[model samples]
Every structure is written in structure tokens, then in C-alpha cells.
Target: MCNARGDEAQAVARLGFLEWAFTEPGQVTAETVKDALRHPATKAPGSAAARAFVDYLRQAVTPLSAGRARRGRARALH
Candidate 1:
């Protein structure tokens, strides 16, 4: 049952990504995320998953826009 649920969730996510890609081709580049995460520094201590999420977000949005979005997220967290 858990496996089935996970598969369904993954399918939904995949469809959503396809829609997003079609809507905004400029975002969601592997290079963008990689560069964003690697740039400035990588020394911030955290779980591997957190670091991975940062990289994923960087790649998932426009560079400038993502930076602004991240700032908002940071403020919200605080």
C-alpha cells in the first residue's frame, strides 16, 4: 500500500513537472540548479537532503526570480 501510494505521488509529480516545463521552458535546467548550489559556497552545514533541496530549487526557478523567492522563503522561516 505504501509503495502504491508512493508511485501515485510520483506520477502526479511527473505530470506536474511536464506542465510546468511546457509553461516555462527557461526554468528547470539542471545546469541552473547545479551552478546556483555550487556558487558562493557549499560550506553551510546541513543534512544531505537539505543541500539537495537547495540545488533543486535553484534549478527549478529562474535564477534572479529564484533568488528573490529564496529570500522570501528565508524570511518566512525566521
Candidate 2:
């Protein structure tokens, strides 16, 4: 049980690092990260990993959509 707990803690820490690393300068800006993830035009075709990074972005943005919805509701009430 202790080993499992340690593994879970390590996983959480790694995720936090990734979240910070992926964030853009001065903000948690995913668009900036997305732009950085793109391959150079000189490359004939982007790598499979680059395409996967973009797919991750699409999935990640869904939660942000709900945050926006909450903010809009707050504004409407004012």
C-alpha cells in the first residue's frame, strides 16, 4: 500500500511539472505551447509525436471551455 501511495504521489508531481512546462511565459497559455509544438515548414511532414501533441491540446481544452462558461454566467448576473 505504501508503494502504491508513493507511486501516486510521484505521478502527481510529474503532472505538475508538465503543466508548468507546457504553460507559456507569464501565463498558462496553451496556444503558445501549441505553436511551439508545431514542426518547421522545412520538414516534409510533421512527426507522429507532433500530431499527438496537437490531439492532446484538443482534449485538454474541453475543461477550459467549462471554465469560460462559468465566467460568462457570472458576467450575466452582474
Candidate 3:
């Protein structure tokens, strides 16, 4: 999923990102992905889901490090 999709543009972008990551591991972080991202399809979250999403975000931050890790779960919203 982190990699690009099947398209010339995406593949080119993916290759560039990969090269950057390899050459500059320190700089190529989550921010790199965030920076490359522009006007993501999903809208920003709001207070409507805060009660449930807050804690979920806190304890549910999964590391991007390579290794096996189970996904975290949040309390039921309802």
C-alpha cells in the first residue's frame, strides 16, 4: 500500500521516493510521505468522533518499523 499503484506517474513517483529513502533514510520519514501527499481524498477528522478516536489514536499508533505487530483496537463508539 505504501508503494505506488500501477501507473506510469505513480511508478515514477514511487521510484523517486524509493531512491530518496535509500539515499536519505533519516530524511525519508513519515513526513516525507506526508509531504508528498497533496489534498488527500479523505477529509480531516473532526470532534464528532473525538470521544472514540482520541484514545484510539493515542494507544493505537502503530510503528512503521519493520516487524510483526498486531493492530490496535479502540473502544466501541456507540
TM-score of each: 0.31, 0.33, 0.29
The total of clashing pairs for model 3 equals: 0
lDDT (0 to 1) per candidate:
0.52, 0.49, 0.40
Tens-digit per-residue lDDT, 1-61, candidate 1: 1122344545544564466456754765766545545655444624344344344445466
Pick by lDDT: 1 or 2, better one: 1
**After superposition, candidate 2 runs with Cα above 4 Å error:** 1-23, 29-45, 64-78
* Candidate 1 accuracy as lDDT: 0.52
Summarize candidate 2's per-residue lDDT along 22-56 as a digit string, tens digits: 66467656665455445463133244433343444
Best by lDDT: 1
lDDT of 2 at 61: 49
The candidate maximizing TM-score is: 2
Which of the two candidates, 1 or 2, achieves a greater TM-score against the reference? 2
Provide the RMSD of all predictions against the true structure, rounded to 1 decimal.
16.3, 9.3, 13.8
TM-score of 3: 0.29
